[model samples]
Target: MSFPQLLTLLVIALHITGIVVATHAVMHTRTPQGAFAWALGLALLPYVTLLPYLYLGRSHFSGYITLHRSHRQRLSQASEGSELAGLPPSCTRYGALARMLQGTFHPGQQLRLLIDGEATFEAIFDAIAQAERCVLMQFFIFHDDELGRRMQKALLERAAAGVQVLVLFDGIGSHALPRHYVERLRQGGVAIHPFATQRHHNRFQLNFRNHRKIVVVDGWLGFLGGLNVGDEYLGLKPPLAPWRDTHLQMSGPAVMDLQRSFAVDWHWVTGELPPMLPPRPAQGDAYTLIAATGPADPQESCSLYFTVAINAACKRLWLTTPYFVPDQAVMSALRLAVMRGVDVRVLIPSRADHHAVFLASTLHAHDAIEAGIRIYRYQPGFVHQKVILVDDDTASVGSMNLDNRSFRLNFEIGALNVDRAFAADVERMLLDDFGKAVEITGDEYRRARYPRRLAMNVARLFDPIL
Candidate 1:
């Protein structure tokens, strides 16, 4: 055939492949809207969308379930003779969300809420410096910035001092992280690996990211929440300055749960479990459960966990998240909570780090306000904390965001504390945050600039992936 004829044949073949992929999407996409969007893109704009879809369209995570099951079985066997096999009946009031996480309630945990990056990093660094046995650290975004270098120094110091250090970062989240950043730590005797999901079965599937930020020292002290190892997290970055976030530092049996989570991800990456020490004796009496959910789960565990927590609210439900694009179930639960005379409040950022997500969140805020749920935006800076307080005695803090990406796409974790004292602390912290935020009334969206309003609606269409 002539060159022109061959070009024509290639175009025809590409269109046919697009159609086949679109059909497959219609059958396997998680949401009807996602399916329709992909199908339309594939059929009408194959040249632009085909390659991107090949990487971003997948919903299931390969090889994760088998690995997770094996880990769960081993953990079960290890705890067979322990008294903490499960939570007491009194703890069942938190609902069945624990089962979804494959986590058990850990009692006698001393929960200390770290308000922002300064306090969080201070606590984390102190723990790492005090480490005698080992340090396991993980973050989705491990930036090569000032704060990241400080963290690197801390780990290197500990590693050089005869402390074993293992670091795992998300391959996609930290793709921009320089090789030398991690190489220096490895050279200092730190074991570092990327939690990658590019195996043969799920190659090109770049949607499932390990978004949990966990730091465990000596299998006893654990820290986790929204802060990553970046200058932005520390309010050191201009334009996103005065960053507002939250983290938790815990000791006692609860730390073991955090250690287990780290070990699971470590094993997934290196096929070797880190040392699992027995749970330390009870240090203080606070109940906490660690909920780790991801695309590997059979059901939407993160979404269900949020829904259950919202539904269990009798008096109030206050949440802080950078993103607010919740799924149908969670949205319904929020509306129902308001209808049942519960005070449902959502706190998001005034100026978001993500433009499309900020626009989508504005639309969600409008919907929430119409449903009688009060929405507030932090005024001084970005609010990146993932925290939820229910009624008077339940609160959660960790890396999960209030969006579809966190609900179904990311490997997320949350520490749910069911203690009145801890909940009160969370409430007080949120109250201060609310004081710094501006409440969104229905008029806010109605009076938005025409272009801004239009952009919001358009962005809402991308909620499934945002």
Candidate 2:
């Protein structure tokens, strides 16, 4: 065809594409409020409004992506597991998250808190050193610097000892990890899986990332928390300043649940499953359940879990997270709890990783503060850990943050601990953090800077999906 003829065909195809995209956008408006918000944003800024929608609008397709994804995963799961007696059946509690980890991930076990980062690191290294059967390590951000290099050496040492060592890192989160670093791991006979690569969109499963920072040693001892295996965690090299994070060094039967968590992700990344080392389930002090919420969840989201845990608080609630951009329901629960005279306290960072998210967090702080909710800003270092303590009777510690990103999109896991002593420790930790934190006053919230204020408001347009 001639140049002009080709141009005419291209324009026709472009118009058709635009029409299809517009149809999808309109169909995505579920609630009247959503429709109004979309209309308002599109009317105010026609072309630019699509920018935010592009990255966050994948869930609004024609099909029930949730069910379709479930069927696919079921097909994959069926081929792998046949033993019904040994597995917990991954049962669910009534009116809650699907029992994805019931019998298979037994949890009538002991729970131990790995308080200090250095101590946690020591526990992890020691676990690796002792792993006779298998070692599975997965982290969100694994730097190529000293800490990463040291881990490589240790994993190499383990692999050389005829132990099965498998390592997985997020392709995007650990993008800075050197190619040679991975090569060295392979050279030592360790299996390495990049959670997903960047080349293919299938590889770019960014939202459903394995955010649960887990390291299962011999399947009996598990380490999990906000601490990534890096210098900032070690206080060796600081990113956004010296980072302080929380972690769990758990033993007993609960370790199997964590092992199951890693196993699922491991199978997804690599067809072959990693062997988990754990003792057979016996009676123990801690009766626990590890909840994992992800993009495919249709019955419950992590937001639902947070809301339930927060609403369950009778006398006290203590929360700490780097970011605190809660969905309206969460903020309402906090306000209502405060209104009911519960001591609702939240600890957030003064200077977190994302300034815009921080601004967004303050937007909803007013009512809580006014209703007697106490807010604290950790002053010593960046507060990257996400934790919750309720009534000094129960607590949750894990990778989920107090933000919309964690609530809806990202894959996150956290342990729901109902033990009184564990709650006491969590409470004391919150109190200590409060002592170290500065307060965010009402005046500061009212008078946030222009760009931050603008960004928060702009981000609000997609809060339901964020």
State the lDDT at 94 in candidate 2: 15
Model 2: lowest-lDDT 10 consecutive positions: 89-98
TM-scores of the candidates in the order shown: 0.94, 0.82
Top-lDDT candidate index: 1
lDDT (0 to 1) per candidate: 0.87, 0.69
Candidate 2 — which residues are off by over 4 angstroms? Answer: 1-19, 26-55, 60-108, 197-205, 237-239, 280-284, 449-455, 462-466
Q: Model 1 over residues 154-202: C-alpha lDDT tens digits? A: 9999999999999999988898999999889899999999887544435
Compute the lDDT of residue 263 as modeled in candidate 1.
85
Indicate the worst ten consecutive residues by lDDT in candidate 1: 81-90
**What is the C-alpha lDDT profile of model 2 across 96-203, one tens digit per residue?**
332332223344556667665687788888889888888878888888777778788899999999998888887767878888989988988999978742224443
Q: Going through the candidates in order, what is the number of backbone clashes in each?
A: 0, 9
Inter-residue clash pairs, candidate 1: none
